[model samples]
Target: MPTEHDQPATHAEGTDAAPLAGKHPAPPCALVIFGAGGDLTKRLLMPALYNLSSDGLLDEGMQIVGVNHGARETSDFRDELTQSLRKFAADRASTFHTSQLNEKAWNWVVERTQYFAGEFESDDTFEGLKQLLSTIKTGNVVFYLAVTARFFKPIVEHLGRAGLLKEENGNFRRIVIEKPFGTDLASAKDLNAHILSYANEQQIYRIDHFLGKDTVQSILAVRFANALFEPMWRREYIDHVQITAAETIGVEGRGRFYEQTGAFRDMVPNHLFQLLGMIAMEPPNSFDAETVRDKKAEVFDAMKPLTAQDVVFGQYEKGPAGPGYREEPDVAPDSQTETYAAARVFIDNWRWAGVPFYLRTGKRLAARRTELSVQLKTVPFRLFRDTPVDRLTPNVLTLRIDPAHGTSFDFNVKVPGPVMEIGAVRSSFDYADFFAERANVGYETLLYDCMLGDETLFQRADSIETAWAAADPVLHPKDGPLPVHGYAAGSSGPAEADALLAADGRAWRPLVDTRKKED
Candidate 1:
């Protein structure tokens, strides 16, 4: 086993002299992951830790212990993680992949990394954890449940029974839970109550990785920091807002899980709603952790509960790209499980009282776009009625969340001509154009905040419940006649989704690449 170094850990290259300015290591603590052998652990967590190490944001005294159900020695676990990290580094598709491994940083992360294997349901597993912690000598611990939802309550109960959750001597004991918090509103409340029975709300971090994205976090800065936007962020000036999360790939082999949790249950209440909360929330008085979270909670509480008529559901059909969702492995031949979800909802608060917020997410769509577009009300076109222009273009501010990391605004500009003419153009900003940092897998910031006791980016119990409540009626509609329409594998979505907006005399913006020129 490797031992902690007395000297400070080495900073990564590119600087080659000192750590990044204004960045420091988080507090020293032990991180114990429950599903240590799962794909999430190998694919995201290890790379995130490696990135934190590369940035000198992981303390030298930090210890990483992975607890999963299996029989393996600590050394073997370390070796397995080493292989996984190297593989992730070499793969170009992975979010945190680099051309090569930074051995200096990788070694530092691995030195603190260890493993424990025991059944999550057995009392002896947590007891073994207690004994292991006694030897580790770290006063602070963060138990990360990366396992399936079924294992959550039992594992928490075991931790409470073992008394590992008790904090003293000015030390901290906390837990980080992955989402799919519940299937519906009632279950979400029940889950929250059950989890809180053992741990205080302060000690629980209900993580939503979507909040960790740079562009997602920048929503606040763009709205609050910029003097150009705050005054115009209301129903009077803005028309309906659209939030779209499309994917080009279908359920990629997790058919069993997807069958149980369709697109709405999978994306809406947590990921897509978080995006809505960011774009639609009232400005917080300050940027304090609780203050920002409270603002988000208010936005969630303001959502008008959905109904069957307000939402549209769809499943992907065969197209140019690949097989239909039903043909995917492990799925039922006649599955009613919807692969697409779209809804037009309203926020009942004063600031956003009559403006509709449109949300849609689905698999195997025309593009892999996750975007929020705020469309301003169109200007009067009486001046251009005779100038070869019928109506003025609606001014739109688009925040692209995935693949493309940036913001862009569209408006009309006068074209050069002898006669009066108008043309639409865009002004855009992309992170890659101005920033030199590598892209992260979205877990780095969430994990770092947990170690430092920050809840600004995490979800709270009330927020979670309200989000679930907003989506409940559509999730389990009392009306059985609600139909699931079909769109091709590479199309935008169902025609009904288009109809949702067409009914309002509006249209969806093209799902073309933001950085590239559109046809």
Candidate 2:
């Protein structure tokens, strides 16, 4: 599946690529999207690829071989893709005049489209896949295993046996796997080892879709590009950082899936930790794969391990006619799985010695919003003694990731009245205004990167383990009043969630509208 959260901006050819150096470039091969019949394939991957193809970026002879368990003809799949493109890709298409995309693109896409259905482990299916790919004669191939985690090992082994492993003249062969890589640290290692047997570490792409968003990418630029922020980005000047990925929708149809993976595994390990790494990673020597990955891995390794008391595990209780986590079908009657998680983590390093990194994610919280709030410490002494310093709420920088795309800062400012009163003001830098363009597809940019064989935004193998290493201690089964708090279905979250920070003398900022209001 495509990465979940990041969005990319569309740009004219010459003006676009120079600034994104070492980040994204086009590729020259066919992409085989497995599980093409699934939701991820129909909704995201196909639409994204079609948009990229329309943009004049996809190379000649590029093909997409979609693998599904069903018996849909190539025409059926093409029609589905055409409709999705019309719906999702239309905005980008119009902006770039990519709508003039004609039948040649459709014909190329449909002609290359074919399906092979059989047991993933069965060798009988290999011959069909091999024959279909023979005509393409492409050097690079990307196999996206959109299937469940259970099928990863078997598919890798079978693909290796099919002689698709390492061709004598092929340029590159890679595989992209989605998250929930493992339930815990030990299982993650075993899974990695198993997959590594067939695909080398360099050839594997473990996707955390959150990393794909445009705002997420902009975070790096926000910090390093400008001199105003990066110098004060450590313990000495900054007070703390809070990364929150909150969802207003509950597990409606994903009840069965939610039974196995709780908020911790689903949100914290991959998304929240990735955000933290971006917030804390040292400046890379250069933007190459090793340089970026090495810097991220260091931040992960320095994460302070949490004891039982430092963490808060909460399973949302039934609120106002809503069903609790345990009430969902196929879930344990008294499952300890937490739907809401809040914790304080420390990075024991020179740059961020004692500053606590607060991260939280939960379903059925207030409104759906993902944001990072960085609070810089205030000045030592206030010259205006009588005035309430509430106006000078420490400088806060917010990076909003979803439902809207933008960045806002809360800084102290002078009052305008002649009375000579002082107050603070909030100013924002919206990505939309900066680009003067409508938002681009998050998946489309990520798909373009994957096709180009760029692993900069994608998660590396070591970073995955390091993230789970920090998360494992709290997620592991432990004893105590492992509290579960409940808030109304449409409410933000449990009351205790507020208490989590209230006791520490902090509170969550009010949910601000990330998107511009339309009349």
Candidate 3:
């Protein structure tokens, strides 16, 4: 294992430089991953941490402590993690067809992994953690709660009693909590209040893994890096924005959890809202946590409060593969839970004054994909008389975040060789074509940010409230009998969804199916 170096050297490649170099360095800390025995830890968290450590972003004194409800010895747990990490590397290697694992660093990561088996609600078990902590001194601590929300308060309460929450003797403390933050507006507030009681707003980092994706983060770069976009990115030049997060898989084995939170809570409240804010927010004064968050909160707060007429909710009815939404396990027979939700929201702001944001997400849809499309308004007047109407399509900038990593811009152009036929041509920039290397995992960036006490991408309490405030009228029980529709599996959502936009003469973009090779 590498000994603690007073000043760790940066990676030789300039591309791998720390995101906020010199502004924030990796703090010497113990990253305690709660629910370490869970699938999330084995599949994502461990692999992410291992990768970060291998990249020289993590410190020599950095340690990872696992807290689990499982009954396994420390050695047995470590071995399990070691095997899982190797399996993760093998999976990654196979998927990307590359051997990028750092064997020496993998061994080091395995060596530093430790486990604590205890009940989160028990104060005594936490005292045991304090005893275990005595050996490591003068370092920061991050409690990563991958567990359920039911345990969120209990675990924090125990941590408070254990004297692990507050900074003392130059040791800083932080906690990372994963979503679904709440089921609704009221519950979200309650959860935020509970978490704030134990940790400061600065200390609590709410993780939304979507915010960490490379393409998603590229939105900032796409808009600001090029002068071509910034000048025309406004309501006057833009028609509307479409944000879609679709999935091909049905509830599958997540039936139980799916029955409780459907697509609205699962995707819209956090992920979709975050994407919208990123697209709509005014240029911040700086890229600091507060500045970016302040801009995002303003966007959410500016959203014209939804009304029933402005919202369209649909629960997936019986499809070719399985039963309808209400038929799912644990769902009430008459439950009005929405499996597919589409809404037209207005950001009553100067930049996006009249433009509508059409957002939608669903399960068992046409394809498995997530993307954001910024469609600019058509040309003020058409000069060509003989060209077909379809030829004059509006320009669009699409950011494909998952199932593929790329961006595309569609603009109108005259046909080649003596043809005045106006037609739209697409120019694309796919990451795969440029970088043969594997894209960094999303969780790694989020985990690294949380450990460094950076909340740039994490959702804040006020933003959460604003999101719910905007979404509540459409989502709440009192929204008054939402309409649910049945759509064929392996097909687009209900025709009603298409009609919802068709009335206004707009249509959803045809997304490529994941099972098929991209064209």
> Which number leads on lDDT?
1
* All candidates: TM-score: 0.95, 0.88, 0.91
**Model 1 CA lDDT for position 88:** 77
- Estimate every model's Cα lDDT from 0 to 1: 0.85, 0.74, 0.79
Better of 1 and 2 by TM-score: 1
Candidate 1 lDDT tens digits, 404-518: 8899999988889876777788888888889885748889889988887888998999999999999888877786736989889998899999998899887787776555576
Deviating ranges (above 4 Å) for candidate 2: 1-25, 83-108, 317-336, 388-391, 436-439, 478-481, 512-519
User: Whose lDDT is higher: candidate 1's or candidate 3's?
Assistant: 1
Residue pairs whose backbone atoms clash in candidate 2: 3-209, 4-209, 6-212, 6-213, 7-213, 7-214, 366-492
Model 1 is weakest, by summed lDDT over 10 consecutive residues, at 1-10
User: Candidate 2 residues 123-235, lDDT tens each?
Assistant: 87766777777777566678888888888888888888887767455367789888778888898898899888887887888887788777898889998899988889999
lDDT of 1 at 417: 85
Residue-wise lDDT of candidate 3 within 21-119, one digit each (tens)?
Answer: 443346667888889999889888887776676566766667788988867888898889888877777777743245556666566677778988888
Off by over 4 Å in 3: 1-25, 92-101, 317-336, 388-391, 477-479, 513-519
The TM-score leader among the candidates is: 1
Clashes per model (N, Cα, C within 3 A): 0, 7, 0
CA error at residue 236 for candidate 3, angstroms: 0.4
